[model samples]
Target chain A: MLEKGRISNIQMEFIMVPTIIATGVLSIPSIAGRFARHDMWMTPIIGSVIGFITVFIVWKLHQLYPKMTPIQYSEKILGKVGGKLFSFVIVFFYIHNTGIVIRQYSDFITGNVLKQTPAIIFSITILFVSALAVRGGIEVIARSAVICTTIFMITSLALLLLIKDLELGYMLPLLENGWLPVLKGSFIHNAWFSEFFLLAFIFPFVHHSAKKGLKSGMKTCLYVMLILFYVHFFVLTMLGVSSVNQFYPVYSVVRAIRVFGFFENFEVIITASWVLGNFVKVSVFLYVASLGLAQLFNLSDYRLIVFPLSLLLFLFSFWDIPNVVVLVDYMTKIQPFYFVSVQTVLPLFLLLIALARKKRSDHV
Target chain B: MIGEWSIILLVQVLIWMIVLFEWKNLKKASKANKITFASILILSMILSFAKLEYLPGPITLLHYIFGPWGWFME
Candidate 1:
């Protein structure tokens, strides 16, 4: 077992913001457009409420068990068997989630950039590299996140360079459909925001004062929300409501970049930045999955599980869903519930139970 | 196109190098643990080559069963 090290609040914040912001930024404008129509920018602001609620639940849980991971405290809250079962479900979900993320990334690359390369090849390559990072443990992962996130932020801003091509008319008639679309968009946004549930697994590992930890995590969530808002807004302005018709509006917007002739096809740069960002994101999930597995089974070494688990993930990525449409449908309609239930609802339930038990015992 | 055989060979050599590096670092890891790790690496290589087409019907069914969670995409 690797010793848990001191990670300042800021470092903890940096670690999470990029992980949440990764591939999601590319898909949001398109996804939000599906429900929010021309009002996609409002989706993120509304969705952030869900993100804030999730952070509060996690913070509350952390408050009860100051330095313990959810995995560590589950047994105490639910009794040993129940806690283990809960931990098992979470571990299972994260492992499956990691594989899908890996698949999504490989599919993206193969579909767009490396057309001739087999997707399994790309998937295995990424899994292999990510496995190496996971083995290095959390500190290395956090440090790399800081570095990659800086680059991600810069490339994200570069999207703004396309402002000359944006049409403000595309954003006209604000809320023309009233609040229905925005509310629906908020549901999708809530699903993405629920990703902050990962902080439950990581917060116990941070070697910061509780107050500082809470502040850093909230700050990180705020930063990511800002980035997501800007990315979705720009994509809508650049491509119009028709942008929703495309699968990856951000990527399309990047492709639309045509400054002075020489700056055409900045999509390559966007792709590079996205790939790196997804790398950190995927690696973090993989790490969480491994850590959860280790804690559940009481394993002494996580490194030993890395290769086999990654191989299983590689295989899982190649399975089922014959084409892209089904994949997109699955992502938009089904994923929100999955993310919100386990990451949001379940954690909130556990936090409430833990708090009540703590209060009862305190009174006694 | 990189020939299928070449990709296989390249992946195998890389796996062998990784095994050698690990072996050097922890000389005392049980032989069984070492063998298990090596076997998994070999299995991954073999699975990598089986091509998407060669997967058996049962395996494909199993794949679908575990694949596709609704919350993954949009």
Candidate 2:
């Protein structure tokens, strides 16, 4: 095993939830609002169906292999060359995806809260912190996740302060366009939800039965759905359709919170908490990329590559993305399909082939 | 010009620090491990000297494959 660490189902939940919700909450509401309008709150509810399906697929695949990650199992299921090709694609997809994720994090910080600071500085700092966590192994990431995710959940409660300012009328005229628009809104969300496939990398190291992992994975999906629904509800009610105009709708709505007519400027607290959440997000992806590369190349240890790969990730974040506008454009249009194809569709094929191969071997 | 040079210098410093820290492990590691580490490090160093924003990258490749489909969202 490349990783000797064993994590419980609960630790798995802690790591996985923030991995999805950390980035989803910041950008999704506005993107959903673009299509669903008053019906935007339903987007997460619809989108989480993909999360559930992805968790089941990952779980089923893990059940078949039981002792191997997708990197190892792909070689078992496909011929060695085909499997290596597939593994290379999966690993490269994640490396590229992680770069975009780091870019999104830095963009949020530099474009919004720390306008004077250079964006690369924020990326490097977060990548450096995450590199330390990745080097410590999965137990360290999960343990830190428990603390960071808790702070993220608590700070997110500040959104409740905006209850008085909500115009419930904005949510009326429900389905203003129709179910088609709501489906369109959920399309982008399915991309985020499909990230549930990341659990496959962690599942082999999980110390529980596959059943328990499945249950926790489903529960995490529910928790994410509710959290996203809660954020979208607030953003839609407080900002209405204007939420679509703001890049960071959750940040915008949080900025509008005025507690007891005295306490304001709470966006900074939310941003700080979000940093904690993104810390977990980036670390997990960094760890997966390093581990995946090690497994792909038959390296003795993943730790040696963490720093160098981070430098590559740094280069990737700045690669041809000139600004947040292009970043958001990529997310809305290309990312959904790109993420789904590699993470979801590819795994589905792997599962089907593995199942067929198993039945044949049984008959033989 | 100064800012760009400083950024390059900072990257070089970071690279050396990583190499120095991992030198002991690298000395005793397998040939595959050394080659992969050195290759990735060299790739990053070369890219760091160039303007990354102007470089054709994965995003550009993905855009070429999926750019036409992006219009469907409109």
Instruction: Return the TM-score for each candidate structure.
Output: 0.86, 0.98
C-alpha lDDT of residue A100 in model 1: 68
Whole-model lDDT, model 2: 0.90
TM-score of 1: 0.86
Window of ten residues with lowest summed lDDT in model 1 chain A: A315-324
The pairs that clash in candidate 2 are none
Displacement of residue A60 (Cα, Å) in model 1 is: 1.5
Best by DockQ, which number?
2
**What range of 10 consecutive residues in model 2 chain A has the weakest lDDT sum?**
A205-214
**Total backbone clashes of candidate 1, pairs 3 or more residues apart or in separate chains:** 6
Q: Candidate 2: deviation at residue A14, Å?
A: 0.5
RMSD of 2: 1.3
RMSD of each: 4.2, 1.3
- Measured by TM-score, the strongest candidate is 2
As a whole number from 0 to 100, the lDDT of residue A318 in candidate 2 is 85
Residues A231-266 of candidate 2 have per-residue lDDT tens digits of 999999998899999899988888888977899999
